[model samples]
Target: MTDRFYSVIYTLSGFAIAPMLVLAQSPVILTGVVEDESGAAVAGAKIALVQQISSQTEETTSGETGSFRFEDLSPGNYLLKAEASGFDPYEEVLTIRSQETKPFTIKLKVGSVKAQVTVTLDDEDEVSTSESNTSSMRISNDLLGALPTDAEDVVPLLDRFIFPGARSAEGTAILVDGVEVAEMDMPSAAISRIRINRNPYSAAYQSPGTGRVEVSTKRGHRSHYEGSLAIYARNSLFDARNAFAKSTPDSDRRLVQAKFGGPLPGRRSSFNVAAERLMNNESAVVNALTLSGPFTMNVPTHERRYRTFTRVQWWPTELHTLYATYDFKDKSRENDKLGGFNLPEQGIRTSEFGHRATLRDTVLFSRNVRNELFFTFQKEEQRSGSPATAPAILVKEAFTGGPSQSFGREKKETFDLADTLTRARGRHSFVFGGRFR
Candidate 1:
């Protein structure tokens, strides 16, 4: 009976310690340090581990020192991934062995992230960590396809949201490739990006960036050619008539845009061209009372616009570059401001044309010093006149008008010269710029 009791006690003890033996045999750990290419620690990096066999995923973030550890992992093939802001993602296949500790060092490269001081290491082995304090929103080419930018009238939709504080277009500043412009005349396909509210405090701008829109154009490829054509059309096929109109007003709108870019024979020079044509027509309901009787009619309004942009980029040397661009626009409209209480005879016709030419030169003096010079010339002429010579008359809310007051003529010519120099030292950047118009 004593021998039987000893055997039973030994079996019970073995059973209770079996789980601890099993757990102690599978001690696997993974450790890593996340760093940038400059050897600076990348804090708050996301680290993920996936087991190949069990398909289990484990996620953790790096500590302030950029160190991460995963303890008590099962021995298997795993996919290790690390990612951080402003840096490219990292991935590696790790084979973990039982009762082993594996250590790794992950070095991430800089990506397309924009910063005030980019990838500059000082003599003290310190990296530039200060970033822009302003908030900015960017719309790339992928998003521009869905926006209502095919028509001139619809372009204001973005202004209403982007520059809500601006009272008018003149109050908001527009920049194209670091150069101030009165308008964006290039085709949508040629546009690469549109950024709002970027660098509000820089002295390079005449006004703050809080009410600014910056446009960047697509660059020409050195090895291949690219082109795109876009056509947008609309018509009043299924429409409801206005409550005051007898039938649905005839409406039609069409837009065609084409863009092409290619490198020159030497590949050191490139050119890009874009052209657009727009035609729009709409019927305006005229409800008015005249000396003869109540007059009601549908007046057709017509608008036509043509715009073209051409740019040539030449690289004289590895450190020096030049850009020349020309833009032209022509517009005509019939029956302007002739709706509602205004009669057909009160319609106004408008015609306008504009030309813009710009030249830019860039020189890189050193790794942290740069200079840029810009010259631009713009000319515009516009005129508006009523179709009828008769003067307009008003009857205090009652419809009475022989001619509209939308007649004006203006011509403007502007020349601008600007220069800027930038120098980055340690964690500070100094910019000196001046503009003359």
Candidate 2:
């Protein structure tokens, strides 16, 4: 009976100590030291460890030697953070493995309280009053979404958003990613931000005195696919008649836009495409009671516009990026005089086509320096004419109009190469750039 009792007691002891042995064999130790920028030990530094999977946190304070240790930790990922008085916080990510010991050194920089000094640059610092005084406005993506827009075009939107005193649709220079674009052809859906610099004095701008419109497009980093479609229409049925007109003027306007963007599979690439079309028609009658009464003379006009844009981007590494973009636009307008007595056949037709292609590369030489190189090629053609075969329209008591012919055509091609380098040193940042056109 005593022998049996001894066997049972030994079995119970073995079962009780098995877990302790298993845990002891898988020991993990994490040791770290906290030091200031001067390499002096920082005692009383608070250290915290956060397990990634379990989200458990353990806290400890450094000893007199500025050393802290965590032993018998389970193997897992952890976030280690150190904090001390009058010093910036330090944080690092580390992994703990079973039966492994690792050591870390945490260096804390002096807090801003230690040195309270503000340095400003004339051209680069926004708060520097010595530079040319100008007001700037930023249009955020949230605001853009809240604002109403008729189509994907931003020119009209910008004109309406800017203050009345600062509004200048033609004088404002449009820039995309710091590059001047001939026109605002990018879709609104793809725009990430817009900045309006009123009365800017920066030499980098094309016409700083007039103003500048800077636009940034989305990079499509967060989403795998994104697209939007919009359609707008207006007709005379919902319009009010003018007091001078005999009847309501006939008018119709329509717009359609589509935009899509997403990341490509593999190689860290992305692409974006946008297309838009607009059509407008209007007919109006001039009331001349003394001449011939209502409908004596009529004017009709029609306009059509088509635009498309595409962009592709690739990131070969963390320090390098490349971009290619293409834009195309076609527009045509026709004006005719009709429904007038003894009126000759007359009309004016105008058409324009524009194309632009750009390539850009961005490289980060170091944490403090960056370089950007870009090339752009643009082509534009315009034609306007009143055919010789058509006769000029005439109005009673106005003047005798004869056959008239006029033709004009213009074509332009431009190429630009530019590079910009930016470097930041102690208390100063420098930007140097040049462009060849």
Candidate 3:
């Protein structure tokens, strides 16, 4: 019995040890050199190893030789930023292969942070109040608290990607704790801080003209539980109308939202969760072909979205920390067909449900080579219903025992997983990995 018991313990321990052995066998490294355009060493420069869409930065200072090195980073794409107080920020993009060390190099230049004349517009005073066009927009917490929305939706406002028109039309990317946001379609549940790279002067970003947008979410926690809500709207009573009692142009506005998140267990290794909801409704009348004749069709719509997330952070050793994150989201919409009594018809109505889940396991193999693996899944279901025709009024035409009611439903699901290893050597960071779908 004693021998059998020992054997069982041994088997379990071996199971845990096997993954580490597999991981130990693979250690990739990245090396790089940083110099000035004048071919001069720029010592004291700060070199930051930043992940794809996150604010977490691992930094190293240049040696007296103007050289920098980072070791043991998990395999993944990384953005390198080299900055000096008196010099323009120098950034470059690089990819690292798992268990593979490669050499990378960069050349810095001296330049002023002069106003970009290429921006084409003068807006030093522009506060960026407009946010109705993009899928995501960022706003100050104070501003978010000040605004109002009918649905009490807050994700759209909190995650709003606010910036000069520096984002690409396809949209910038976002991340939370080194995880890719755009690749994950950025579920609102895991968002914290956001930084948009609209025309980023840094070469580290892959998108042309620095068109990508990146974001980060607050993980674990420094504070306890905290949440807030926002709502905004404007009606005819608040607008100036003409003597005809007709609403003047620009007399329509509506919005509402709310967001709440905080620490589950505040610390280096803890847990936390956040959630947000939002909704909007608005109406307007345009006078193009007719004098307030409503040439433009009148349309009405209702929309809603919800997001939730949970995360765990663990660190048993100074060189290692484990993090796991999961999130889910649901969105739906319906509209009232706009037109005239000429051929009045019921507006279209549709509803769609979607969800996503992800699990990431990260272990610090070394200061330069971090080992991480991620699993993800997504699902979306769309079911649309159209107006049931009046069974055509055929002459003598009323057919008895006409068509009966028909009903249906549809759904789809997708799954994906990724494993990676990274190591930073010298000025180069290498990310070697693979993904499955």
Candidate 4:
């Protein structure tokens, strides 16, 4: 019985140690050289390799030959930054693969380092070697908050910010956290940043004619909580009367928004939730060419909208991240585009419901290669026409009438799964991915 117990213990130990042995055997190497524009080596240049997932940093200095190397690195994505005296700072994304040797040569241009140069992933000033030109704009959360918007909707804000000539007639492609989304219904209070890429030539994106709009949501911090509330109101009573109207046009608009976010109890998890409601009541205007239509006409209009968003994030390890998000919206409008006579038949009532959900996983396979896998599902439903209980009435061009149709409905659903892999080989960076819907 003692010998049998010893064999069982040995088997358990072997199972635990096998993975460690496998990881130790397949280390990679990263090598690079820093040189000047005049083909001269720049010695003593400071270099840093920051792992993208874990945020672990490794530093070294270039030798007399301007050569630097990092050995025994696992596969994953990293940010490589180099700084030297009398040269502009340089940074680029690097991907390393297991059991591979990657090499790079960085040419430093003549510039003042004290000027505080920064190279970001989406720097507008930097022209990528692979692409001819890129036009892009980034809107920060602070700027977004300062801008006035209705019902916390981001679509109108985007339309106002993008140049009229640059706007796409077909509509802009929207992406949230690198995943394509069908609509731009996310509330402004939940967004951390908005990036508009006009006429981007990157192979990674398949966008519409106008370009792409990328939105990133805020991730709550550990052990911290934040919340905000906003209320806006507008009334026609405060406005000056128009020359054509007999009395002040009846108009009222009210919007309320709330957002809250904080860390979960334990295990490096966080959650955020946001909700908004908007109500608008106004008098519709009619332009009638009829000789008997000189009198004033006031048609009551009403619109109501509600939206909510929730997100949860879990960081199981330094090199792994998981997140899930859900978004919902309901909107209804009444008395739209009624006839000049304000007849019920001309009125159109519409209601819409939208839902979106996403599940994502981000992992660092090594110091040089990173992978992002995501699954998304979306659904939308729309209804138009008068209420079923309302009586149908019909009349000729003379005057009053009710809608003939009681209801019309439409629904759409979509599902998508995507995988992206990034690999670095010396001076070249490669990105390849596949998506299914």
Candidate 5:
């Protein structure tokens, strides 16, 4: 029995040590340099190496020094390939051994000529390559899809991305597709990306870009139809009672957003449309001490908002394109400020309606020259009223009475036009534009 026990322990220990021995095996290192037929270093050359047995591939690009390295490779046969623009492809097979370091030299010859063309417009195709002086945060569609659609406002979602104390007293500047707007008029589903520019000081905008938020809307697909609908809802039945409320006040919020995009009837033309509806009804707990004694109640409040946006794109010629967009918004709120120490009579009702229209044209004059022109018109109307006409009354740390002090009507109209020209020469790019509002 003792001999059998010792034999079993030895077998079990060997099983444990076998894996460690395998894991301790040394890795292979493959390093190489790419060069042209003239023996000149070929920078930015693409390098691909594949393990024949595993069919696994690894890729890298040659640096300015024309050197590349791949580490931790297993011992195997590999197919090596290198490619670069204006150069012929190079291929070879390499056999690597464990714990071995191997070096290779690859040479590429000039390839046949190929025709390629690309069109770029002012601001629309601007690409940034430097990250020294600017920082930006982007919120893509995938991130937006994870957020609650029933959210009452976008500010709460945006606050986290802005730099500390970056917003000015006047608030951040909002630009939708290079056009400044008073507010976002499209649903979240219609937004392609939301970007925050932390170091915007360019002259293109009316305000500095330091606290600017740029929003780009999705474009219609020219070939296929795409559509989506999202609905969000929450009721009081699933919510816990508020600490100050007498009971679980009846409250509910519902939101619906739908968007569709597809090709239009004409060639090279497309259209995108989106709409949203939100209805929110909630109760606010009020705990106050009045002349009659303690006054406690739940004040019911409601809000409704509607928004619609439509965009059309048409290509009159191969080098010229036109875009038009229209947006409408309507919102109303009842008992806006009737909670806390203020009584229901002090509640305020407010309504707002707005319409915005825009037209843009982009023309490519040459391979290196482009021009863009755009115009926008907007009209906004607002009205608010109070239930009681008396002046407001307040007792420190106690109660408040009388009507809300906010009551007014206002109307405003805006007209904006801008034109820009861009020219690129070699590595340098020049841009010129002016705005009228």
Candidate 6:
């Protein structure tokens, strides 16, 4: 990173787009063909994810061919649900691994329609939680909005969502959908629900747990959507209790964001859409006297960020389903500093911006085998140069270093692509994947 390095700006188009970039799962997927009574492949069933350990829940619909798939789902204790027009829905509990796609063939017994089915999976039975400290906590739908935030900043970002004063939670990995949610541009508020797994994972899963956090977003469900508009701002409400509390002048800040989404109708497909804009501005203060008389300098900081998403699903046949998604985003920040003296004083300003898009599809050839193909494109551009300063007729100022003149901008681009395949049998499940630059 450099002062002149220009990064592409992420811009959100009109309409509500999922703020899901930060939590989107990989397009790669695993399909669980579901069948109902009479050994008939049931279609139009509903499947929901129950976090075995935390008992949190998220829902998606099953496709035709008595089958349903878990797409972009992270590793956790997950189960399945099978539904029919005039029959009782069936629920099954199973474990889903990271980067691994496993298939299940489930048969449901005929039951009265009036009966309510409930399934529970306890992860503690398999993964020991006997000797772990600093537990991980997940906040979902209700809690997400209920909790307070500073200008709707990124979740777990800038060390937020962490215990106060706690240093870095290293060994921490956040999985969104199925891909790692490591990008800083992702919005934490977009997460519909989260699951936190701690250390001491089971031997069956020879994986060590860090401050491991798994997140899921709104996807593949009928009539599911969310939208919100907010205005957040703060002015110098100094209530410093401690002495020598790095005192400073009072300042004000403000931000606004809106989002909404729902399920796409398909026998084996899922869909979602969301959009948001976060605008922030803060005032800086300084009291002093320049070469002239008494005066005060006040500088305002401005930051703008926006995100959008539009996706659809096509399950033309049982063996093949198409998932198409498009996303666009733009973010920018600017800082303006002024002098305390004459109203017209020389000042410096800086700003930055990022962009990304992706498309992918998954195919289930047989009960135990699957293939995934997808590609993502990204670019960044930035512009930073000091604007011409207004003339100061007061005392002449001399150069401290090189002559103060205009500076040019620098830009950079990045490309990423990947493909994966998976197969599952009785006790052994295997997955292989490769990526292109």
Evaluated with lDDT, which candidate comes out highest?
5
Q: Tell me the whole-model lDDT of each prediction, alpha carbons only.
A: 0.78, 0.73, 0.54, 0.77, 0.81, 0.53
* lDDT tens per residue, model 2, 388-417: 775554466543244545578999999999
Q: How far is candidate 4 from the true structure (C-alpha RMSD, Å)?
A: 22.0
**Which sections of candidate 4 miss by over 4 Å?**
1-134, 160-169, 208-210, 287-295, 339-344, 386-408
Q: Against the correct fold, how does model 2 do in TM-score?
A: 0.62
Model 5's TM-score against the true structure: 0.72
> Model 1: per-residue lDDT, tens digit, 43-117?
999999999888899999999999999987887789999989888888999888765665789899898865684
Q: Tell me each candidate's TM-score.
A: 0.68, 0.62, 0.47, 0.64, 0.72, 0.49
Predicted candidate 6 versus true structure: per-residue lDDT over 1-437, tens digit per residue: 64334332222321224534433454435676666656787667666767678877766665667667656666667666566566666777877755557677767666665777443221111122322434656566677666665555435442444333232244355544433433534454455666555442422222354344555554544455545566666666763432312254435565555555555554345566666666666544434444455445455656677776555566656556555545566766554443233232343444445565555566777766776666665666666555444433443342111222334465666555656676778865576777776
Write model 4 residue lDDT over 1-437, tens digit each, in one string: 99999999999999999998897667788998999999899999999999999999999999999999988778899999999988999999978866566579988988853566442221111112213335677888999887776556668668665556655566676778778776778667788888877666566655434567778887777688999999988999888976656677799999888899999988489999988898999887543433455435667889999989899988887677888999999998997767455454467888999999999888766656777788999999998875555554533454444454546888999999988887767766687889899
> Of the candidates numbered 3 and 4, which has the greater TM-score value?
4
Looking at model 2, residue 68 earns an lDDT score of 94
Specify the highest-TM-score model's number.
5
Model 6 misplacement above 4 A: 1-137, 155-176, 180-182, 187-189, 195-215, 223-254, 263-271, 287-296, 316-321, 336-348, 365-368, 383-410, 425-428
Tell me which of candidates 1 and 5 scores higher on TM-score: 5
Q: List candidate 1 stretches off by more than 4 Å.
A: 1-134, 149-154, 166-169, 386-388
Task: Please give, for residues 263-375, the per-residue lDDT of candidate 3 as tens digits.
Answer: 44434465666665655444323222332343443345565666666666665555555556666666655543322321113334566566666666666665566666767
